[model samples]
Target: MPETGYMAAAVAVCTAITWALRALPFAVLSRLRQSPLAAYLDTAMPAGIMVILAAYTLRGADWGAASSAGPTALALAVTVGVHLWLRNAVVSILAGTAACIALTALAP
Candidate 1:
């Protein structure tokens, strides 16, 4: 195990690195507001986020198995359906979670 002082220093360094990485892009963009790269990045960021979310949603899915709840696929499907039908995130999420719980309880 690391010494307390060493662990604290490590944590501080990690925090500083994380903060710098998160802020680096916005800081550079602010200084280069008129750059083509900045404009492209601004529009492409959402697409990148969507891709990350998609990967995360399916990260634990068992594609080989016919059915599995390892990745919460049914919940995701219900949430998306509710969002499309009702256009409400809160309601959809609540309903989806309830549905998942209920279905799980009733599953054989």
Candidate 2:
């Protein structure tokens, strides 16, 4: 068994290493806060993510079909309109999703 002083020293060193690992990100993040790349991503990522999501969601739709096309197009319109009107993501997504589901279900 190790001596008590040796055990305590080992524990202290481990605790310091763990603390430094945990603190590393916060230190890096403070540096990132002033970075130009971070600044651009802050503004661009939201719109880019939205576009990627929209594309992924719509890509599987059978848009050439008359029945599927109308509901899909109208759903997109409703989504854009609601987002423009309310400026709310949850309500807009819900309204758009509801419109798409209801319209597709009601379609012949």
Candidate 3:
């Protein structure tokens, strides 16, 4: 077994590295916030990501499976509805995922 002093030093080093890694992004993001590229990304990336997500989720769905809780279509609808209602991407994605899982799980 390693000595306590050695373990303590390792833990302290790991903790410091983890903290620095977490803080580095915020430090860099402040600089990025002033860039035109960042501004463009801020406007463009979410929509792009959402489009990709929707395409991926729906790509495999059997559109002809007409049901009240049609998983993929209903999930996409829920995602869009939540996004429109709250204008919050994280919440919308999560809500959509939850709706899809619940609907799929409960479907006959």
Candidate 4:
């Protein structure tokens, strides 16, 4: 059986370790905020992520069939157009998603 003091000390050590782990990322990120690489990533990551998402979304489409591919193509177009017109990622994504749902529902 552990003593009460030993148990208290163990709990304190665990709490400190947990706090440090949670805080480490913010500490490192605060330091990295001034780095050129972080700046570049801040600018580049959105476009890169959008491209990757677009590719992933369309990769499984059956290009030879209009019925299968039409909704996806229209959704992508709407997404791009909305993003370009509104310059808002959230609105673009929502509009594209709504377009896709409507198109799919209307499809036979």
* TM-score list, all predictions: 0.60, 0.55, 0.44, 0.48
lDDT tens per residue, model 3, 1-108? 999999999999999999999888996688889899999999989989978986764654546444343776788799899999999999999999899888988888
lDDT for 33 (candidate 1): 78
RMSD of each: 5.2, 13.7, 9.3, 11.5
Q: In candidate 1, what residue range of length 10 has the lowest lDDT sum?
A: 62-71
- Note the residue pairs that clash in candidate 2: none
Among all windows of 10 consecutive residues in model 3, the one with the lowest summed lDDT is: 60-69
Residue 85 CA displacement from its true place in model 3, Å: 0.8
Best to worst by TM-score, what's the order?
Answer: 1, 2, 4, 3
**Tens digits of per-residue lDDT for model 2 on 1-108?**
899999999999999999998988896687788899989998989999988988776775645434477888898899999999999999998998899889989998
Q: List, residue by residue over 1-108, the lDDT tens digit for candidate 4.
A: 999999999999999999999998896698888999999999989999978986875774555334457787898899999999999999999999899888988988
Clashes of each: 0, 0, 0, 0
TM-score of 3: 0.44
Off by over 4 Å in 2: 1-33, 60-67
> lDDT scores for all predictions?
0.77, 0.86, 0.84, 0.86
